[model samples]
Target: MAHLAACAPLGACTTKQNASLRSQSARVVPRAHHADGETQAASPALTRRGALAAGIAAASLVLDAQESGAVGFKKELKDKRRGRTRIPEEEYTKELQDGVKYVDLEEGTGEVVKKGTKVTAHYDAFFRGIDASSSRQARFLNENINLPEPYDFAAGSEIRISKSKELPLPPQALTIGVIGMKPGGKRMLLVPADPWGYGDKGYAEVPPGATIEVLIELLSIGEA
Candidate 1:
């Protein structure tokens, strides 16, 4: 009689356990109904795919907007360049090769820039233009004077502010422009709208066909 009483409670417990498992499974597994009234468990794989597709679409839209904005900005720059006139060559003190011109503001007395020397300097750039009367003015574009560190590059290589470090060390215009410059010297260069000055492709905020007026202050010279 004792064993029978124990067996009866065990059977009741098993029944209760089965009932609880069924209730939990029903709550956890969602069902989907088809048009023909066939019911099936909802697919977690399908839910994940839907979410992935939505994320990709949102990302594509953001990319498209960014591309559109860049294109619009480039067009605006081109239009602005078309309306501007070049500054007269006589305004500069001396002319270097390839039509690059410079006027010495303050001559440096420290070290001369030579081949393979790394030059460090702070610079301010402007877009130069003239009016119908041939009077020229510089419109400020960018500057690195307030920055804690100055630009350091090879003396005879190309340097574009908008480009990465992969570009050649400095532009020929700059190389020739800084030929006699020493530490603490300042010079203003009028770079022509050629390959030396971003060329027809232009640089960030510098319009196409724009002549760049750069005021460079020589800070230091070191071996590369």
Candidate 2:
């Protein structure tokens, strides 16, 4: 196994290691799609809030998967030269629209992530540089760099809001980006630096007007 680590502000540091992929044992909930592009889970037995809480509880299962040595809950892609897992990349340049862009690296076989679905995923967020030739290799902002510890959160849930107009809103782009993903799926999201990402003021590491690219891998989806 190989471990990758990085230091960032807010005490956000992650260590990722390569491991085999395996399925987690959990109940599956039926998923439904809405006209607005949001997917919803069918859970009449539980209230909306209850369903949300149940979704969050599913995150614990990710720990079990990790303990089993399945870092991203998926197969490892090895880079022979560096002796590390290789990240799948887009073949061509993708233009960003609607303040975001995403590409699926691996399609998951599990249930689709809908509203109120608790999702566990691993992500690496990078700062898109002003120079096109150097953007892909630019510096990262926060969260996991290449380490694959799963981040657990509910889709469409409001987390924190930035009170300052200069700062970007929290959880907006990320929540919307992960919707419809299935367990084991890997996706790359490009978020514009406006209301969707670190805004004019940015953060301690992120600069103003810098775009962010996030690579996300869905580890598990909790039963509704």
Candidate 3:
């Protein structure tokens, strides 16, 4: 993405505005034409004034371009979200589907997850050991459960949820795997790497194609 200043041409200034800007520039930077056809040099003060005026014009253009870009970007995001294919709501069940194996530690009596529902949960993720051996260490990867307060999902915990518009969103292993879960439920999910657990592009300490275990405790569900 280009900076606002760099996208000034994208501002698309109107003809009237362009003419007005040219007139202002001409007034600030006067050129004296001699009878002998020699051009007289402008005064130092006038030169500085012209430069300042030009800078202000550029700044205004940058501001306009930035505002336009911001508005367009927001609209595009909204439209994209609207056009997205919504995942169908699943029937309430304890059975896990889509290659996601889960073990429910505590059953929830709250509302079940449906389309457009917003859910808040605290999770602890760990790199699963080979062959489910008791001797193998399941190294801790990340957690969002030890905070004093929740942010956007769990606030005031110094752990702010990222609103990044980047590619490859959070792992579907958790998002899709958590479908049909109700608030107050606790489940341990066994997530495979390909197309689920970071899709072969392992993040941070987790290696590529690594399997992971996520212990999730659902907090609340509300209207999105």
Candidate 4:
């Protein structure tokens, strides 16, 4: 896989808001597999937001995770092209339960990530659209423009929301999204705009109620 890099503090992209709106909640509903081995499920209620108080609490949790060695990253890439493991095309596209959909691009070889596990990875996020041009060439919200180096953070840590016009969603979404992944594994997450992403009032670049497609590559996982 190719790598891109840009120099900017992660905090610069997030924002804090004072409100009591409920944060989106999703449960890992398991579904039975068909002969094709695909997982399927009905959609759940979706809303995205983090109360200012919750944001502060989540930040505290991140610091504790870091101190416990639950979050960290590598400065270099061992193998950029071929990750540690790979998943089959059909298997990667299997149907998912709940509203969130995921396709495992690479099946990693490291330990499965748990709640407190520290993780290192590179992510490319874009707004999904139906129009050909919008869908095919959507701009990336966050990506490594030049280097392969990955960012380190706790799997369940809550970072501040992006400062861009986009409203902040719950930080746990990333944690829940990457739970079963191992180091070197890559997955594409189709996050519903409602509860999992920006709600009615979309960000400056993304429209209201637009689904967000996030390509996450797990570089490494550390001990808790």
Candidate 5:
């Protein structure tokens, strides 16, 4: 059941996508904004040609984007072996041996990752990687490798970019990547499935595909 067995994994790598991520036409949407940074808000939604390239995919930000929430991003610090946590045990065992499949969702207050830290996250990335349905599945598929990045990514399996079953997506809605990391610093990224737009061969809202989610952060370096 590891998917991609032969059929329905990506439906034989289907093709017929005329362009996704919200049908682009080529930047120029901004209209206002200029007070502190001194004018810069033409808002083609902050351009790069809209979501990367706009069709099939161009932005989901990170690129296994399977480390989201309820593993709940936390905060608090002090250390010797264990005494503070907002997620820190060598950054939670280097995010579970860098395979992205760990979930300990409780037992906090033992943070200690010195260097000038700052972290903030609220994620959701599930099309079929298992974040709920509790039975005994926790190795680190809680998804969120910083959300928002696009410029021609192509939405094959889980890099989908379909969003618009009529327009109704607002579940903790995400965005806020690149801040400051270097105080015991660590950074991991992925999530570029074209703005989590699921579509290309994926159905049932988000399955038949699943890839994007791996946002790890542990900054303290230059504090900004």
Candidate 6:
């Protein structure tokens, strides 16, 4: 600490409101001056006072004014994405007819389950027979359970209750029961009040004697 000060004059370095910012790389974006002195682009150095806001606005403008066709890229991609997991409307109609109930897995794609690979995902779950519409009363997480029993697969990989409840096997997870699913597939599971950890007593969030439903997606499995 003394070495740096000794190397320079006492007033050479001083603290200022923007002293911290001054030491760091400049985030300002310069504006381009056209023939009329109007801006075609923002100059980071000249953006002094409103640098942050100006940079953000400039970035937004740049992104907004991207190649005309680029704006439609998202819509186009969505159109194509509809084809990836796209269940035909006819299939949906068929499901509506059969009365078979299933929550169309959201963000259910992009899973390549082999023997062992790590994964992660979030799910919204609820018990069945609770009006069949909307009644999400409980949520649980970090229910890490290693599959194929007893074998350590990977660290930091997580499997939620909904996903774990489906499988028939286990090595003792926070909760028992998750749909045994393939790598990329997502599942919704319902844990009966009895089978769930709570033997007799129940709590506020979770009913004392009520079944619980969970939704989960296998994010990844470690390489074996």
TM-score of each: 0.47, 0.44, 0.41, 0.44, 0.16, 0.28
Candidate 1, lDDT over the whole model: 0.64
- Best first by lDDT, ranked: 1, 2, 3, 4, 6, 5
- Model 5, 156-221: lDDT tens digits are 212123454222221111222222222233333333334433334443344433443333232222
CA-lDDT, candidates in order = 0.64, 0.57, 0.55, 0.55, 0.30, 0.38
Model 5, residue 108: C-alpha shift (Å): 21
Which candidate comes out best when scored by lDDT? Answer: 1
Give per-residue lDDT, candidate 4, residue 192.
70
Model 1, position 37, has a per-residue lDDT of 85
Model 2 lDDT per residue over 1-224, tens place: 12233346654543331111111112345566789988777666656878788878887777776766655433232221122233334541443446577777788887898878887665555553221211122233453233223456787676343355222223245666678788888777777777666677765456777776666667788965
Better of 3 and 5 by lDDT: 3
Please provide, for model 4 over 150-186, each residue's C-alpha lDDT reduced to its tens digit, 9 standing for 90 to 100: 4566776663544672332332245556778988887
Residue 107 error, candidate 6, Å: 10
Candidate scoring better on lDDT of 2 and 4: 2
Residue 138 deviation, candidate 3, in Å?
A: 20
For TM-score, the strongest prediction is 1
Residue 46 local lDDT, model 4: 21
* Global local distance difference test of model 2: 0.57
- Candidate 5, residue 175: how far the Cα is off, in Å: 16
Q: Candidate 2, clashing residue pairs? A: 16-147
* Candidate 4 structure, TM-score to reference: 0.44
Local error of candidate 6 at residue 195 (angstroms): 2.5
Which regions of candidate 2 are displaced past 4 Å?
1-97, 129-149, 160-171
Worst 10 residues of 4 by lDDT: 16-25
lDDT of 1 by residue, 10-35 (tens): 45657666777667655665678899
What C-alpha lDDT does candidate 5 achieve relative to the native structure? 0.30
Off by over 4 Å in 5: 1-98, 101-119, 122-186, 189-209, 216-224
